[model samples]
Target: MTTRTMLQRPAFHWLAAAWPYALIGLVTLLVRSPTFGNPILDFDEQLYLLVGDRMLHGHLPYVDLWDRKPVGLFALYAAIRLLGGSGIIQYQLIATACVVIAAWFVRAIVRRHMGEIPAIVAAVAYVLMLNVLHGLGGQTAIFYNALTAFAAWCACKANDANTPGRIAALALAAMLALGLAIQIKYTVIPEGIFFGCWFVWRLFAAGERLRRLLGIAIAMVLVALAPTGLALGAYALAGHLDAFLFANFTSIFLRQPFPTQVRNDQISQVVACCMALLTTAGVGLFQLRTHAHGRVYADFPLLAGWWVSAFAGFGMLGDFYDFYFLPVVLPSVILGAFALRGERRGFTFGCLLLLWPCIFIPANYFSRHQGILQTSRMVSAISPYVSGHCLYIYDGPTILYYLTNACIPTRFAFPDHLTNPIETRALGVDPVEEERRVLASQPGAIVTASRSVVPRVAPATQALVREALVRDYVLIARTPTIDRTYYIWARRDLHPGPAPLVDPRAANPQ
Candidate 1:
């Protein structure tokens, strides 16, 4: 073949290899189903959903729920509620869409760095990765992962010499995405820091003049600050400056260590977590050595740093859970895919054999097969009956929020000395006093974990609750399962109120 034809053949071959990535993307979207059946799992997820539902009904997020997340997430949730209707299925679908998009971005980044086969493998591994699969229902997990992948893609594009303008645009886009991700979960801050430094380093290495680099840096900063600035402005205009500052900025910065009750101690769980960290670190180091002199892929280092930082950070918090590391694991798989590149086919098969067992064993053994699902369904069934009200729940916010479309407030308890002074003071108040205050002020149902309630409450408080239930309220439903207790209490005197006017398009600007 002529030289021109030889060159064209390689380009054609590369284009042909893209089919697998497209196939993986299609399969990922097809497999998208509501895995957990109900939107509630962890307390935080449920809280956010309730807040979102309230926002849909013309209530502001931080102002009403006293939540810490950025306005962007609330806005997204509000939009989803508008389009999909007031159902957990709609929320699940939106979260699923975010995962699918994130998967596609992962494939794109891998394809750019390693080529088609490895990229396809990485994308599949990303969707199938145990954390991603299990935490698909989580709002922060889904949004943050998607945002991280998009940021990585932008960083990669930014590093390309042939497309400087395109790179600048992509870099700015990445910074904005990073800002949103940071709002969703504070863990994304390191991603922005690492990539910002990398941008400077690349500019210096390329002999770009200082003045031009400074200008570029300024532009990037403005782009990054745009979303955050907008969110702050929204809160300020709504007369919720205190809530915005205390919840989003101060409270998040002062996150307390996890409580002892939620801490995990299983030997296998510990081993699996350790292995995952080791594998990720090993792959990252290998990539650094191999690509040290090559063009920056951007995804590898950002993800590797996210993994190390989140693990170290969450490990310091005593009540760590598996889902806490969900955002970091997506990039780890992509890095692992790069590490497995060029290996013999047989070796790849062996790795899969070892990996499958590690991934499935914990999921099958520890996760109560249908326990969470059942709890979620039961809660959802009773939510409509108590829609325009508050729920006092003792445990698991996920199920409560998923079921009732109302915010369930838990009495905040201080387990760490590091807690904010205000929060500590609030927790210091007697539980009886607090429960009484809530009962008198917030007209709603009170659901308690039967076993926990029977033992934990003092005699006086227990008697008061029983009296209220018998005289003032009626037992609407009771769902008892092997590992959970659900009781729905509706007020007898307060008849079913008018359906709250929920405006789906009230708050979402974009």
Candidate 2:
């Protein structure tokens, strides 16, 4: 075949189109592999995985595990655990894949509006921003943000096409993708709404009749609701509908607001992140205006709308955490990529702007290496103590529960439910009663963390669990070399007798 004909072949075209960005993505993955390979276990990661373990054993979430996280999050973990066993390697691999895919879409979306260099820069910016903004280490945001990015790209692709059937198919797929994303984290709901509205507007702008537009909107809404509907249906069939509803939806409003000082810290962190990206993007946007073209102007609304939606989603709960800033990273980078439009000087400047994150994230990751090692040692040391026995972590790291493979005596995983006043009120659980009941069984190991290490426990519930631990158990081991505080307690009666020593008043009373 002639060179032109060979180059025009579909497979060749696909490879020609894909390989460069794919190469960039692979390089991105390699740069990030150190952090991904050596997983730094987060409390959230532990609880989600623990819930997955329960699900693996045929236990449901709200009914058995008692966490407010959406069903889809645990389901992802459960699937990963089933396929790869309870190791961080599979989770990290999956997370890295999600990030790469998202970065690829960021490039595809930007390339449609700008040159290849700017597009590649946008993709790299996304990878850097996500890591530096604390979006790493197996967080749910990694997966959902990728889904949203793909959805955004599909929306752009669908908008540019003239065929109704093609548009309809893309719209349906996008909505379903977003529905799945929403189930992973309700925080993504605003972005979903933004996309839905944008999709409707695109159809309407295509000059469809009002009636047809209404019909299309209804169809899209139905598609978007499908994942959640199926989830609700399954819970209903299993007779866990109330539990599912309360945990997934109702309990969020009941969560107590953070203390004013803590809330201020969270706010400052969120604001700083937003300002860092936005200020940089704003400078780029000014340059973009100076070199304005119809194409760039046309794309402005889409990028801006995405930014607003992401910002809204991040702050949806009127509270902030480090990971919450993740969704905004892509839009910020894409907007900043516009500044690379002019000449070599502009391109060089944009490269420098994006390079700043490369410096700090590696340093930060290395600094935390010590903490990761300490955590590993602690988990290893404590694992043997709870083998084949029930364990209770009284205001301690939830990761220990997962590491030990022990039976949990209570639904509350992190003691936040029993100790955080807001959490207790939100769940409407009696903390003292819950503690008394958990202690009644006299678990083989009751691990109590030092007060300094155990953050955010309510005073009353802390006292209640502590008192029960003191009365019922004897200290067996204390982690000496680990940097953090950890104490292991064995039931006092179990050492001397086969049957658990029962005190009728203590066991039966309120």
Candidate 3:
């Protein structure tokens, strides 16, 4: 059979086609197992867990607790929380499942160009490459990557459809998938734009009239935006459209820009983390370019458009942190498999060996050993002290709230909003003023990380928290980590003011 025939080949009976997914699922867990249950796995995941927990207990996203991420992201976590108690293991497992599903999509998409064995290798690499960029946990990209890949697959189906009705069905499905992905992370917008144009162009190529195409374009756009529109509608019904708008949209612009040098350094770090990927994937693309008109050239533009759009977003949104690279991982790896088109299984493993060293660098930042396990010890220490009051995290992990079973005294509970210099002005509220309020509220306990370790510390806010610590709170427990120590401070008024200190003579009427 020809390559295109293989692409369009009917799936085997369910039993025959089920093994790849089953194998990929097991590989995902085995690779991701180390980081499971690590609450402090990623700071962003920590916030998601906290939001999910708080959301269950009558709190809302923007109004009740502040974060600029879309509500869908929080809603996903909230759903994860329902799997049981706190959602640490649950979210990780769900994220792993997402990775596995996404890998399957990757294999399905690239198989036409790169045959079955190499295509499967490409899929496994996507899962393994995630660790190279800290995608081992519940990063927003974890969920949306799968959704975006599914959307791309739908678009591919549209490309393959011979019947008009089938084409329309696949196009709408792709648009709706992209729309849901937007609710999860706005970064996917660039890729969505590509898919939108792809649909319009495909319909135009199919000889649809301009007016009908216009209507189709409008419908696709609306479908993609519907989830976000629904989220806003919910907020509107509660009469807090402004709060939702500001938190979800405006607050991001409020953040201070990083210094040029710092951003350059971040870009450098991302590049370093991706070194092996670049070497191997880069060589593959070069090989394809040299051999463009060969049999491995099916639907090349579709993948290229998706890859370039995501890559541009990654480049332009520098310093948004490295997880921005996660979405780029999908297309790059599949495209990279272009090198293995007619090669043996040995070449697949050879390509993977190049990515091995790159994995360990970013992998160090997260691990079951490096993350929440150490500081979780402080939970037992701070739990008794913070029994009935909020536990303020001045410059520490946000997961402590979930761990210690304490409330956050303020909405700016995500520490970066207050403690990170780059976020000094980004949150709608004043970070320092918010910090003052948390300290002033006399929280049951406070957590702070070593300045050396948490480099994003805002000097002014750090000073303020330090002064508050000396004046009103006392150091209770210090937890050591790979980098430095994280300190827990308890409110000094642990005693009940010495029972109001009444004079004996006055009580006796002397």
- TM-score for all predictions? 0.75, 0.87, 0.90
**Model 1 segments beyond 4 Å from truth?**
1-18, 34-43, 112-115, 130-134, 162-167, 253-255, 259-281, 287-291, 296-319, 341-350, 353-391, 396-433, 441-444, 450-476, 481-483, 490-510
lDDT of 2 by residue, 1-510 (tens): 899999889999899888867776786787567665353435567677778867988888888889887898899988888776556667877888888888888888878767887788778777777666666567888888788988888888776766666666778888988999988888888888888888777777777778877888899999988888999999999898999898888889988787878768887866665554576677666766665566555456667788889889888886677678888887777777776766885656576657666655634355346556655765664565566667887756676677667789888876557766667667747777887788777777776654433236666666665676657766555543233455666676655543233323222111
Q: Is candidate 1 or candidate 2 better by lDDT?
A: 2
Residues 304-391, candidate 1, lDDT per residue (tens digit)? 6655654554453344455665665666666665565556742463266235534543332233436566665656645654667766
Indicate the residue-level lDDT of 298 in model 1.
48
Measured by TM-score, the strongest candidate is 3
Comparing 1 and 3 on lDDT, the stronger one: 3
Better of 2 and 3 by lDDT: 3
Count of clashes, each model: 4, 1, 2
The best candidate by lDDT is: 3
Worst 10 residues of 3 by lDDT: 501-510
TM-score of 3: 0.90
lDDT of 3 by residue, 1-510 (tens): 887766665674564678877887787788788888777777788898899888999899988889889999999999988899558889999999899889999889877656777677778888877886768788988899999999888877777765655666777898898888988888899999998888777787777778887888898899999999999999999999999999888777776677777777777877777665666667667666676563334366777788889887676544646678889888877777776644474476456634563446454445576566675687877898777888887666788888877888988888777777777776777778877787788888877765433345677777777677667766666676665567776777884333222222211100
